[model samples]
Target: MPLSDDALDQLFREARTHSAWLPKPVDDALLRQLFSLAAMGPTSANSSPGRFVFVKSAEAKAQLKPALSPGNVEKTMAAPVTVIVGMDMAFYDYLPKLFPHTDARSWFVGNDDLIRATAQRNSSLQGAYLIMAARSLGLDAGPMSGFDAAKVDETFFAGTTIKSNFLINLGYGDHAKLHARNPRLSFDEAARIA
Candidate 1:
């Protein structure tokens, strides 16, 4: 069944990319819950490539600071948590467990290009799922692609097969600080029917 109007509004219409935050903290359990909800979203062949790093500690946040563009730094630092959404290149290794009906892992084992493409595409979808999951849980999100991905990968995913895709600052938003909601393209302008 489709969600009710209120649920839809909370997840889309009323949802904004929050730039200012309330002076509140996001609990670890809530973060875990957000991940659990997001993980349920689908991906091709069940290749769950998204990996998240919740940068909540001051030290970790500091490590992340240098990679942020000037515009993203202040709001990112002020938020309760900044989630580094990354794509795991070796995600196919878990296919035996995630998509266990057959030998799915063998499909990508020797195909670097296919693995890279699938990982990037599915992880981006998973990041979108994370945004919706956060909204459903009454948290605001600011998804940003302004940061230096290579720097973020070096700082956060070094020695791992993960590559940073984007960042999301998560917290209770201060509605008063939001700019007016901008106009969106109408369906006719944004979509096409074959």
Candidate 2:
């Protein structure tokens, strides 16, 4: 059966990108649950390249501060948890476990162009899944790509194959601080039947 309208509202229709948060902290268990839900989403060759870094500690948040753009600094720093959605470039190494039925790893090994494109694209899909998972779990998300990615990488993923894709601030949002909803493109303007 399809999900109810209330579920649709919770996941999409009524969800908003939150910039202001309540004073409560998000539990680590909830973060783990969110990732578990997001990981179930489909990826090419089942190569789930998404790697996440939950910057929840004061020290981690401080480390992330310099990388954020001026406009993002205040809201991000104030957030309970800021997730660094990342792509693991060496993700094909896990194809044996993720796609055991076929030799999928061979498809990407030594293919730099394919690796970069696939990793970036699939990780972005995983990140969107994460946002939806957060909303489903009664949390708010503010996903952004406005930060200095290189700095975030150097600070958080040095000597690792994982590269930051985007940031998502997660928490209970203060709806009173939100602005009016903006417009979106209509189906006619964005879609076509082939």
Candidate 3:
């Protein structure tokens, strides 16, 4: 069954990109649940490539600070958690386990361009799923791409094949601090049904 209008609004129309967060912390269990829900989202060839690092500790936040742009530093530090959404270049290695019914790994094993494109595209889709899942579970998300990807990868994903794609600050948002909602482009201006 389709969700009700209120449910749809809560997940989309009323969902704002939060900048300021409440003082409350997001629990580990909620983070786990968030990932569990996000993982169910579909990916091409079932080549699930998204990897996440939830930065919550003060030390970890300090490590990530150097990579953040000035405007993003304060809000990110204040956030209860900052999720590093990444793409694993070696994602196809697990295709045997994730897409076990077919010889899917062979399709990407020797193709760098295909591997890169698939990882980036699917991981991006997974990140969006993460945002929606968080919202559905009563949390706010602020997805940002304003960091130094190289520094983030070095600091968070060293000795690994994962590359940072973006960052998302997660927590209970302080709605009082929100700016007025901006106008969005209508379907006529932004899309078409060819």
lDDT of each: 0.96, 0.97, 0.97
Encode model 2's per-residue lDDT on 1-194: one tens digit a residue. 99999999999999999999998999999999999999999998899999999999999999999999999999999899999999999999999999999999999999999999999999999999999999999999999989999999999999999999999999999999999999899989999898
Off by over 4 Å in 3: none
Instruction: Assess candidate 1 and give its TM-score to the true structure.
Output: 0.97
Candidate 3 per-residue C-alpha lDDT over 1-194 given as tens digits, one digit per residue, 9 for 90 to 100 = 99999999999999999999999999999999999999999999889999999999999999999999999999999999999999999999999999999999999988999999999999999999999999999999999989999999999999999999999999999999999999999999999999
Residue 127 of candidate 1: its Cα lDDT?
Answer: 96
User: Which residue runs does candidate 1 get wrong by more than 4 Å?
Assistant: none
lDDT of candidate 1 over 23-140, digit per residue (tens): 8999999999999999999999999999999999999999999999999999999999999999999999999999999999999998999999999999999999999999999999
Candidate 3 residue pairs in clash (backbone atoms < 3 Å): none
